[model samples]
Target: MTISERPVQSRQDYDGRSPFPGAHEHPAASRTQVGLTGAIVVLPFIALVIAILLAWGRGIAIADLLLAAALYVVTGFGVTVGFHRLLTHGSFTTRPWLRVVLGVAGSMTFQGNVIDWVATHRRHHAFTDRPGDPHSPYRYGTSLRGQLRGLAHAHLGWMFADEPTSTPRYAPDLLADPAMVRLARAFPALCAASLALPFLTGWAISGTLYGGLTGLLWAGLVRVALLQHVTWSVNSLCHVIGSRPYRTRRHDRSTNLWPLALLSFGESWHNGHHSDPTCARHGMGRGQIDPSAGLIRLFERLCWATDVRWPDPERLERRRVDVARKARAPAGD
Candidate 1:
């Protein structure tokens, strides 16, 4: 799972009613908890370094490279399309079986169990960059020193903090779904399978234990590390460095960082997302490649997804910064 399922109180005064459900903040994570979180963040980088060193010794296998790419696409889409778009935002409707499949695939990303993932994200939207936000890069003030520290906090530090989002308050729908509950409970097993699948496939293909080990390092650990940082960068860099083409709520600093678009499966279109959270497509502008939206379109064609929330041109036009600015200009200007 993620943090405790236990209801916890808001830690700071909010703009309105607290999004978090309970009384006082949960205690700081215990030393053992922090240690585990560190391992999750550090071990993958360690594997990446070892993989590079091993590649230097002998030319890397094509099989390992192919496996890494394949697994990365599957697991990455699992998070971007399934967890973030479908479950968290209801960007579209899908068959129950497909929902289960998507949830299972997302759980393999090791981000968190499906329930906790949905809960935490809902709370993020409810409070955004303000005080109740669980991982805003602006957690500290916007001073240069604070910005640097908050970037770290948003990128990889907040997981070690003991703050708990209330699942009942933020994600009771997921909790009520028995299939989703089972999938959430299966998170640990799904993670094991995520690592094992690559190793087993490489071993079967290459007929060697060395091949399996290499696959585990590259496709398993290294792949996880890359996805984790890319996802976290959306939380950190997307807030700090990029263009804001659409108008969002006050103090919501989400931006669209094109450099990260391809790697993030179009999730780097953060400004579009923050502006229209329920839209199936985040890449609302021309030439904004959105692989996740493409996948959703494919699902629609296959009758797997319906009621897709495609972008509304008029609504989007209204939210454009230039449009809003023009609307406020004097009639005689």
Candidate 2:
């Protein structure tokens, strides 16, 4: 269905004109609550810097760096390929076992359980930059001070809010799936394992408590903080900055932020994604590096993924704003 024709809850239901029908009402966060939430978001990056300073003379171990890089890849792809592509958008299909594995890996990223994450993302897509969007940089207003507040809200402040997206409305498929339910329940344990695994790996490689601590510091806290910001950037900056190379449904301001391309594992190709939400490849044009797409291709080769939704040139051309503009121009020109 066209975007305009898609079903939407009444504006009053979503725009806070009325309380969400059956949803819990959360008061605005108090100063203490806001402070705590900000600390939770910021302290890790501070600790990471301190850890780097402490390791200055000794230098970070090659093993720790490698462990962090490896874990980053596994967990990052778990979000990009698994939580995002496979489950949320159905960009491709895979074996049930692989699906569970991907869910587990994504859960280890500590980005909430798959169901909640998917539900939140689906809601974001549903409203986009409109009044109901969960995290739009334009939420506050167009004034400078308002934009700054909106940026903060979009980047992280919204997480502290008591508002919750309805799982049944956004992710009923996952809610109905036994495997996904079990995986969601296992999220806490997976989070602990995500940290502990790096520590154990560091200890195993260097056989020292110091090595283990450093591993926990770098691979655990720092890695999580970095990935968290990269993901949040897509919600905040991708909507406010960067190039909107493709057309999307009205009010979707998603843009392609090339700087975040590698870090976000192709998710930074926001325009392409909003243009074709289910397409497996976001970086459809030349020199658009998309490691997530590469991983998906590898899975396809290994017979682990099937029916991949690689981009179609004709569809892409149809979606291009330039093409639409040319089509609208006078026939003589």
Best by lDDT: 1
lDDT of 1 at 247: 84
lDDT per residue (tens digit) for residues 122-148 in model 1: 988987777667887777656687678
lDDT of each: 0.85, 0.82
lDDT of 2 by residue, 221-290 (tens): 7888888889999999998799877888665678899999999999999999999999999997899999
User: Least lDDT summed over 10 consecutive residues: which range in candidate 1?
Assistant: 15-24
After superposing candidate 1 on the true structure, give the runs of residues whose Cα lies further than 4 Å from its correct spot. Answer: 1-27, 323-333
**Which pairs clash (backbone N, Cα, C closer than 3 Å) in model 1?**
9-22, 9-23
Q: TM-score for candidate 2, please give it.
A: 0.87
**How high is each candidate's TM-score?**
0.91, 0.87
What is the Cα-based lDDT of residue 188 in candidate 2?
A: 82
